[model samples]
Target: MTQFDAGTEFDRQVRTLIEKGFGELAGLSADAYADLLAPLRATVTDRAAGMEAPTEGRVPFVLVITRELAPIERAVPLLTLGGRKRKPGIIDRHYAEGDLVRFVPAKEVELPDARAYVLFDVDRGEEFCGAIPNDAMATIAGRGRTPLTMEEGIALVTQYPAALAKNKCFSLGGSRCGDRRVPAIWISENAPKLGWCWAGNPHTWLGMASAADRAGSLG
Candidate 1:
């Protein structure tokens, strides 16, 4: 994987999002979307100074737009893997639009109300691969960490597609539909896909993704 300076990575994220038509999805012009995120550039630079790149894990931080601004259904389609053509990410047919809305962040995960924020120390928890989603959530909480929500999981992949490696995919255990369904991102036909798995069932290839914490605003 290639590493970039904090400023460069931040710039790349903005450029990538705009190129993917995130602004249009959010009903804003490309220029407006870039301008809206201007305030976050300084925050990324400052926070990045004190943080060291993890030897293993996703990335130091990821820039994320909330579901309110970029709906998961729309945002997932923007993702591509292995440099292939962008494929639309899909929610399981079992879940209607209403079911998607019910899958909020777990109580242990506190998110800010701001439309955009930074998620730090993101990790596609490979160590937990094969563990039940419910058990993984408990372990993550015991370590004082929070599991990644569906939107947050998508945001990580949006910034770093390489994170969704084959045989090493991850689950968004932080978002629960008040039932057994846990959202996950994995490779499907060499493209990134958004789908779900049973919370109580263990999959050898799927780990629960998590983060150390999140910041809603730089201010």
Candidate 2:
């Protein structure tokens, strides 16, 4: 959790003085926090291996990032939870009771119960389509739930709407609707955890979390 003063360089790039929004974390001073974004970017070394960073300079990707209790991205949560059954257009997955799930920085926010979710799986399937669910709609308004690994969460989207069963053609590189690279709902909703500044793509009626915008609201 890094905090940059309003006129600092980081503030110009991020354009939000990140600390201004976090009034709840009064106990922690702004000087003590550091944004993990820079170091996380360094983690990717080989683009040929598919382990690469996004173009727009990691515009704050907030996905569910599910994984087993194991360390790093070794244990795909979905694979461990339910065999990686490659369906035609979706990738179904889950998060067990004690699965180890953590966002990038691991600072604030208590995390949801880590329910079974379904978002476009960027790996085996085509490019992720649809808008990812945002935090406002994804997370419960009041109490926070348990944490889930990224592996387990993607499964739900793979097997969504009972419509996937009808998807005859296998998506080689595009999402279900075709060409919608933006995920309709992303669990990878990265929260600033720097102190409660979470945002993302779209979301469902259940109000899921993501880096995308809001999908369908309860209203």
Candidate 3:
């Protein structure tokens, strides 16, 4: 891994600095380390597709590698994870032992060249388990213990004895409730057309929670 000073601009943008034991890029050759660092050093290119310009108050991102494994050349867009057999976006798609790197996005990153936002590679056995964001947290916490459907999840948040109300929740785009444009919240308690919420990460939870607040006129 590449080495950096404690408080440099580069160090600030790194998420795995602490994890990497003071920002050391372990197990990678010097050339590979440089390849990973190049994107962070370079400016957004003119041909960069779907890249959002840096904005004030926008969440800064960092790259966290799971130690040794490098990403595959053909990166699969996360949205395409679950194919036809399982409805996409309804539930987290199950991955095989060495399928692909399953990562939770920390924020909304549309940039094709977003080297900083690459998730930890599960294929290489990175430790990503433990407290994740609200939605996935809710799901995992309720795994085998509670109802996982959209209706039940909404009830769990909205009705009396609402359990998940405190934590933010979001239904998938084509959710069972039928409205893709509008987001659901505690007050609304509406089941999505697709029947489930899959707010992928913390940043997504923030957006969904805010949208839910607005939709229910809570804000």
Q: For this target, which candidate reaches the highest TM-score against the unseen true structure?
A: 1
TM accuracy, model 3: 0.25
Number of backbone-clashing residue pairs for each candidate, in the order shown: 0, 66, 11
lDDT of 2 by residue, 1-219 (tens): 344222232233222212222211222234422232222222211111322222211122222222222232232221211134322222223322322222332233233323111121122211212223232223322333222223322322222212121111111111111122212222221100001111343222222222221111111
TM-score of each: 0.91, 0.22, 0.25
Better of 1 and 2 by lDDT: 1
* Local lDDT at 42 for model 1: 82
lDDT of each: 0.82, 0.23, 0.25
Give all candidate RMSDs, comma-separated: 2.2, 19.0, 17.7
What lDDT is reached at residue 98 by model 1? Answer: 77
For model 3, give the RMSD to the true fold.
17.7
How do these models rank on TM-score, best leading?
A: 1, 3, 2
Model 3, span 1-219: residue lDDT tens: 333232243343332233323223244554455455545433322112343332211111223232133232111111111112211122223333433232222232122232232211001001112223344334433432111222222222211122212233333221222221222322122221122223343333322211111000011
Order candidates by lDDT, high to low.
1, 3, 2
Expressed as tens digits, the lDDT of each residue in 73-184 for candidate 1 is 7888888764664666655566776777788887667786558887888999998899999899889989998899988988888878778887789999888877788899
